[model samples]
Target: MERVEPMTLFGYEKLQAEVKNLKEVKRPRVVKDIEEALEHGDLKENAEYHAAKENQRIIDSRLAELATFLGCAKIVDPSELDHVKVSFGSTIIMTDVKTDEVFSYTIVGGSESNPDKGLISFGSPLAKQLLGKEEGDEVVIALPNSKKTFEIDEVKYQEIVFECD
Candidate 1:
């Protein structure tokens, strides 16, 4: 059985949008490309046909993946989260014990992790260490390179809003 994973509302909406685009726009475009390529070709040496087929395969794979993801996704409402302890969808601020560098990260599901944007997967080392920890709690996290200590400064849950493109 596939485990149902928690996803923020924004993440769920994003996945839905991607699925729509793939089915509506990309699928037809690839089909057209394949048809046009078929008209020009000897099957064995048709580069355009081969390329279109490969693209179709990729789109089909992604569509299946997205379908599975959406099927098992549970959208988490930020307003329902407890602010006292860190958990999935919690935005946390922590200060490094050694360098005193402070950083903020939103703990999200694995599918929505974007380190560059300060979104960390709930299963990540740092998020795992922070889970169930409260503000002012000190914790140590071991990374691939080194072990670092941090003091939890704050934990809050805020609704994530994604701008439609």
Candidate 2:
């Protein structure tokens, strides 16, 4: 049996949109390019044809990856989560014990983690330390350079919405 992994609602929607774009738009465009390249003559020395074929291969690989993700996805709605303690889909505000700096992060599944946007994966070191911890709790996270302690100042559950492009 295949293991079903949890994916935030936003992540699921994002991947679905990507799959749609690749299949409906990119695939057709690549096919057209390949057809035009074939009209350019000799198959053995056709650079355009080779490039188009490579592009098609890349697109197919991406499509397969997205399909696999969708197959194993179990969408988790943040709105259905509780704010009592830190968990997957929880938004938390924490203060650095040493530097007194504060930061906010949303704990999400591995597939949708974007550290620059304050999204941390559940499998990450920071998220692992924060999980099941409540507000006012202090936890230590080990980094590549050093270990840092942080105090959880707030915990909340809010829906994460993604704007489709």
Candidate 3:
């Protein structure tokens, strides 16, 4: 069975835009470059042709990846889910037990996760640990270096907003 990934509307639209841009703008330009390179000289030792072919390969690979991601995407509206417990699209406010540090995390799709921005994928280790947990529950997350405990202070379902840089 194909795995279905939960994605917010914002995330879905973002990916769609990227795919469209690549298909319409970038891919055509690369194809033209390859065409121009092919006309330059002998195919045996043409550096420009080889480089263009490599670039086309990279673009095709990325397009394939995006296609797969879009095919299995399940758009989920965060506002529709229950906020009483931690789950996909839930925003959690937590406190680190050891250092008393506060952190806020929003569970998002793999394509849109930004750890620095507190947007974590639902499949992430931290989000996995927090799933099914309720507010006031303590969760232990196994980091790469060590395990840290956190108290789930809030499980909220707010509108998921995507910001452009």
Candidate 4:
């Protein structure tokens, strides 16, 4: 299996929990539902039985995907980050020159990003642009319409310890 890039401890735990839930709780429940539906008679005309079986297949597929990710996961702690240069688990403050808007974002792992919560993935265009930049540095990012310039107001290494899925 290919290794997952920069997995957090929290992310690993969440994935494990999801796998457990799917296997222990969901899988059995689905099996029981399918069994009950099968008791209703001919499966050829049984929508409930087919639907339950389909749901089980989906759940099993998701479980397999999660297992693969977990098998390849290597948990990394943010406190281990030493490079001051922009990288994963860094909080960056920047000012958009064109809009004169200031914002702060925490660069996180790809699996942990919640854009609405101000956590951006390192793979994001903005994060890519900010990478390797320091405070007072300026970077121009190519947007869909036009290039946007941003001035780095601050760069701080953050050891992210709290996460929710």
> How far off is residue 13 in model 1, in Å?
1.5
Among these predicted structures, which one has the highest lDDT? 3
Ranking by TM-score: 3, 1, 2, 4
Of models 2 and 3, which has the larger lDDT? 3
The per-model lDDT (C-alpha) reads 0.88, 0.89, 0.90, 0.83
TM per prediction: 0.93, 0.91, 0.94, 0.88
Better of 1 and 2 by lDDT: 2
| Per-residue alpha-carbon lDDT of candidate 4 for residues 1-165, written as tens digits (9 for 90 to 100) | 465667778878888888898989999999999999989999999999999999999998998888777877767776678647777778888899989999888887776778887888877987888888988888997989989898988888766656454
Kindly report which residue stretches of model 3 are placed more than 4 angstroms away from their true locations once superposed: none
Cα lDDT for residue 43, candidate 4? 93
lDDT (Cα) of model 4: 0.83
Pull out the clashing pairs in model 4: none
The backbone clash count of each candidate, in order, is: 0, 0, 0, 0
Q: Candidate 2's error at 42, in angstroms?
A: 2.4
Question: Candidate 1 on 32-78: residue-level lDDT in tens?
Answer: 99999999969899999999999999999999999988998899876
lDDT of 2 by residue, 21-76 (tens): 99999999999999999999998999989999999999999999888989998988
Per-residue lDDT tens digits of candidate 3, residues 1-165? 889988988888888888898899988988999999989979889998888889889988988999999999999988888989998889999999989999999998999999988999999888888999999999889989989899999999877666885
Q: Give per-residue lDDT, candidate 4, residue 69.
A: 76
Lowest-sum lDDT 10-residue window in model 2: 156-165
Cα lDDT, model 4, residue 152: 86
